[model samples]
Target: MSQKSFHVAVVGATGAVGQQMLNTLSEKNFPIGKLSLLASKRSAGQVITFNGESHTIQEATPEAFEGVDLALFSAGGSVSKQLAHEAVKRGAIVVDNTSAFRMDPNVPLVVPEVNEQDLLKHNGIIANPNCSTIQMVVALQPLHEKYSLKKVIVSTYQAVSGAGAKAVEELKEQSKAVLNDEPFEASIMPCASDKKHYQIAFNAVPQIDKFEENGYTFEELKMMNETKKIMHLQNLEIAATCVRLPVETGHSESLYAEFENGNPSVHEIREVLKSAPGVTLQDQPEEQIYPMPALAAGLPDVFVGRIRKDLDRDNAYHMWVVSDNLLKGAAYNSVQIAESLIKLNLL
Candidate 1:
């Protein structure tokens, strides 16, 4: 609530990540002279409370951006593709939380801790990196700075919430059905609109998004490509395998990285990550302490642990990373970009 507040709008305000965005804005006390909540036609007129005030949701349309200074979008790739440009055209800065324009070559894929400076190059819109990518890059930025990165291999245990609110409900309902030995139906998982859906309770699905000709799912490719882009290492060799777990909120990853320079000691890497911004070092093998999705739920910082050098390669190391997919991955990161814009005088 500053004197120089701006008009702000949260598109898709009724969805999970969208609700989180509104909560984040209120928690951070983001300067807002006016607040607009927008959603699809079906959700229009729904009521949402923020700062103890109720605001009716409006239908998201091109004209909704009029007089808005900042727009946070989490509707979907298709919705973003349709309205983000319209928002930008109305002089509103858009921080898109979808893959709509992530690799557009013009839009900056940003994780503030990793490549905030890239925000200066953004043209009206900034793309938030994948949830898994965001946490990984946050934990890796300091390491990559001290020891140049050569390659990365990541396997992610992602949460069902990343798919959306309905997916989380599906997980709960399916879990109960299985426990009770009752029949249950699954029609929204792995990829909701894909050719088929699979059970996400008491099971792990290897596919996250649609598969490409190269045999990699789109989610895996997003992590691989987004890491290189955010780290500004265009030629960085990276591979990712993304899987959906039964967890409700946090996403976890097992990361193996090779450095260009000789391998740094495990202690050295620990010391660096302990001091890295937005990263919490939780490695303590002897005491059985490490990052877990349950422990990381509702937290903002990326948790890193299980540090050890690769068995055969002297220049390679592996670690575990965990974070709340909805916060740092989607909502918090978008708000952070708006803060960066103000701090960097770009707004």
Candidate 2:
């Protein structure tokens, strides 16, 4: 007897993360009998290759999802909001890689390493956490399990790639212009929808998404809220300050956390992280070694290091976490969810 294969669809097939998703699926050798590449009407005619086979990009409509057993969506929040249910209605289980259904009470926000069981409860759609949030939780979940996480204070140094492919190109163009002292346009950094744009070539923008009424940018709130939801810690005291850095890929975070358990030694924390699933511990300060975004790019596992105890708070500790925002942050996580679905026999 042969194993069953799925008819999988990749929504947003033309974008950066979308491209990575296709690459990852090929790299992982997922059991796919048929692959459908979907994008906006404007991107419909583009051709993409998967597993040495050519796949045509099609305009994503509710009708396009007809026999799709799984749909991986990364187009954008609006597209997900508009078409996610349509996919679900057509018998496709959706693993959404956007903010669209993340906070929905009925949807499961999943990080397989942290909450793989949540997938079983998903009501047709499963929301992938924010790129920054995904990596942070991967590194923190093991420690949280051992120590019972009480609070988290994170400051993110995100990359331009998190914005989109155009932002990465803008950073390149702006850097060249800056070096030659030529004039350049500032149009994409901070947030494309914001009133004013800032250069991201050699500067940091202290914002990721639109600001909510409470003053936290949507990105920050995603990290804060998504962590709580994924961990099932509704009262987890978490605060986030997300900043866009000039780096082209990977995201880094400076995290300070307090645990309910009494103070644990740095060695103990390192021991916990050493065996933590989906985490790579790279903390060797004597060798001046630690996780850096430049080194973390292109990797699927979350790299964590710089473990130290806070001087004032006995139960508090700080660490640094990094990962490829395009991989584990979005594409890899979405695919992992689909793999989990099959493993759990939910597909």
Candidate 3:
């Protein structure tokens, strides 16, 4: 960390992930000379406090990037696509949290624990992977380095927070409606822009983004494809199933993995994870200790637990992973990328 500070801008200042960006900036004590919060017209003029100082939210425009050394964007794909280049043109490096730019060949999608080296390769805009993907890669990267991972099959129990602030409110209202035996309305889960919405109050939704032609939701495909991209492992095999749960925060994942030429015992895995950066090991089965989303809310670190061997395969293992979705998975990851850029001397 440097004594001198940098000017920073946050796009989508009123959103779920946008709020996380502010929390992360303060919690990390990021040497911020100035912080500018940008949102749509609807959220403009709202006030958010940072470092005990009041900062009024401003409307997002191309001009927001002037004098900003870095920009953390979480508004949406369309917003990022429109303004990211403009920010870069103003000499501000962009850490974008939208699906719009993740797969771009010109952009680098990064998680610091997973591929900090990729920061050195950015051309101005850096992409942040999906929240579920971010936590999984943070846990898997160390193990992959030790054992040379061959495959990954993961299922995620994501929270309503990943959907947005509105979705969280919808879940709460619908739950109360159901409990009172009122006609519960369904208009938020599954997909908001779709023809219909499903109830997420007491139900689980198997979809995160809309389905693609291959039958995998766009969110699931992001994990599978983005994993290989970030790891730079063209031959790696990955599969994902993403589901939205009623929880307000935290995302938990069950991962099954196989390693090539890996014969390490469970203890060895624990030792490796304990030494990995931004990761914590909580694998005590007999004591009933494990990672759970309910316990991971509002935390920055990735939590790992339930480490064990799969009975069906000798080189296979199973694990549970947890983290705050909006934090680590989105806003925090974007901030970490900016931090890495500073450390790597790229900015």
Q: Candidate 1 lDDT (Cα, whole model)?
A: 0.93
Which parts of model 2 have CA positions greater than 4 angstroms off? Answer: none
**Alpha-carbon RMSD of each model:** 1.1, 0.8, 1.3
Model 3 lDDT-worst window of ten: 187-196
Task: Please write out the lDDT profile of model 2 over residues 140-220, one tens digit for every residue.
Answer: 899888899999999999999999999999999999999999999998887888899998888988989999999999999
**Candidate 2: minimum summed lDDT over ten consecutive residues — where?**
46-55
- Against the true structure, what is each candidate's TM-score? 0.98, 0.99, 0.97
Which candidate has the top score in lDDT? Answer: 2
Candidate 1 clashing pairs, residues 3+ apart or interchain: none
- Writing each residue's lDDT as its tens digit, candidate 3 over 1-347 gives 63768999999988889888998898999989999999998999999988899999999998878888999999999999899999999999999999988999889989998888987778989999999989998999999998999999999999998889999899899989999999977887878877779989888889998999999999899999899999888799999999999899999999999999767889999999999998988888899999888888888889999999888888999999999998898888888898898898877
Stronger candidate by TM-score (1 vs 3): 1
lDDT per residue for candidate 1 within 1-347, as digits (tens), equals 53578899999999999989998999999988999999999999999999999999999999989999999999999999999999999999999999999999999999888889999998999999888899999988899899999999999999999999999999999999999999999989989979999999999999998999999999999998888889999999999999999999999999999999867899999999999989999999999999999999888889999999999999999999999999998899999989898889887
RMSD of model 1 against the true structure: 1.1
